[model samples]
Target: MTRFAPFLLLALVACGDNDPRYLISAPAETGTAGQVALRVATLEVRQVSLPAYAAEDEILREDETGALKPVQGALWADTPPRAMTQLLADRIAARSRAQVAAEPWPLSTPAQALVDVRVSELAARLDGQMHLTGQFAISSPDQIVRERIAPFAIAVPLAGDTPAEIARATGRALEQLAEQVIATLRR
Candidate 1:
């Protein structure tokens, strides 16, 4: 019984916190119809730069006091930077005629235009809205098109306070950003 007691204790110690972790993913569908014509034939989307809090694995919300707090047991399914860059690239390619890939661009030929996005704020606020504000720059490597930097502010109403709702709103906000980028590329 003494030998069995040690094993039982080990088992008990191994049984760590049993909290159910929810993995959140931002959906890429923008719900907008029709393909946009792009001046660039191919575009490269660099890894998205997220704020320290937004880059964390935990899903965060901005409290009434303007503090960012993580939602318990909720986490991003993929690395935030990579996931967001890929999402933007996919969304842009889907909505436009240009071929898009997230950097490091995997094509033999160089991309005509490169897009870099730096997100300053990405959080669900106490006002029941998910806010995404950032600046995106489009640079032409071969000098094919005009280079430009654009600031974007997007907010989507949260359906509920749950982490899932925040994730959905985040997706919506990103979709709007993608649309804006597409519009800029058309010029």
Candidate 2:
């Protein structure tokens, strides 16, 4: 009976339809005391490119040339990853001890720093590869401050057959990506 009780709780939690709030929410972070003039280099999310043939069948597939073809799922502007960027920006606002701002404006001259990210790959495979990678770059007006390769992924079971399941999987993958991006900014 004790074991069954725990299982019941697990089943109930698993049945939840509520998408995680953090996945889409990016409320502004509280500010710290500082006057450092820091501006978030308008992150240009290079429209995560992918081969056109990817849409014909499953997204996660390989080519005859033996290269692992990347996948391009929905580029929903309001997706978790985009929101995660806002979350990171919020965190940077606090952590950087510099006034942080995010938007589409390009710097007229040169900002004090920049954060550039290249989305190399993102998607869940039929075999559960769930690969995502990006290169991070931080630059001062004069020189690059940091550069690194960050990736996030996981291979869970193929048990749940549903779009929501895949969305959840992608969300989980992006969460890892969020962590990586945060780490890059910290360094």
Candidate 3:
């Protein structure tokens, strides 16, 4: 029994809590479901640029001191840049007549327009709001559509400080951004 005790302790240590809990930012809800006219038929979305903290796997929260802190035991289910790029493409496509895809431009034919988004801030703030601020530019290689650079700042009230609530707020913010982008494409 004494010899087995050592092995039992080792097994217990190995089974201890070392794995991080992964949280997913839910896909943006399809808002006002209807196709809107777009200047371009095919749109390519470049990889989104996220802030250093925002790009990290650890979920961060802005504390009262205005410093970002990681939420212990919580990690993002997917890479932020890739996830956000795909999210934007999906959201935009659902709301517009255009077919949108994340870059590498899946189709053999060239895309009519390209979208690049740079996110300066994306965080759950101390004030119980999820803030998303950034600039997005649309360009056309063949001049099929007019080029434009638009800035966006979105905030969604957080129901609670939990990671799940933060993710929900993030989704809502992205939904708002998608709507704004679609509106721009309509012009």
TM-score per candidate, in order?
Answer: 0.85, 0.44, 0.85
In model 3, the runs with Cα more than 4 Å from the true position are 1-33
Best by lDDT: 1
Candidate 2 displacement at residue 130 in angstroms: 2.1
For candidate 1, the per-residue lDDT at 113 reads 96
Q: lDDT score of model 3?
A: 0.86
| Candidate 3 minimal-lDDT segment of 10 residues | 19-28
Worst 10 residues of 2 by lDDT: 42-51
Q: Report the C-alpha lDDT of model 3 over 131-154, residue by residue, as the tens digit.
A: 999999989999998899999999
In what order do the candidates fall by lDDT, top score first? 1, 3, 2
Error of 3 at 104 (Å): 1.4
The sequence of per-residue lDDT tens digits that candidate 1 reaches over residues 1-187 is 8979989998998996564444334554565478888999999999999988888888888877888888887777777888789888988998998999999989899999999999998989999899999899999988998999999989899999787888778877888888999999894
lDDT against the true structure, per candidate, is 0.86, 0.45, 0.86
Give me candidate 3's TM-score against the actual structure. Answer: 0.85
What does each candidate score in C-alpha RMSD? 3.7, 13.5, 4.3
Model 2 misplaced regions, further than 4 Å: 1-103, 106-111, 142-144, 147-161
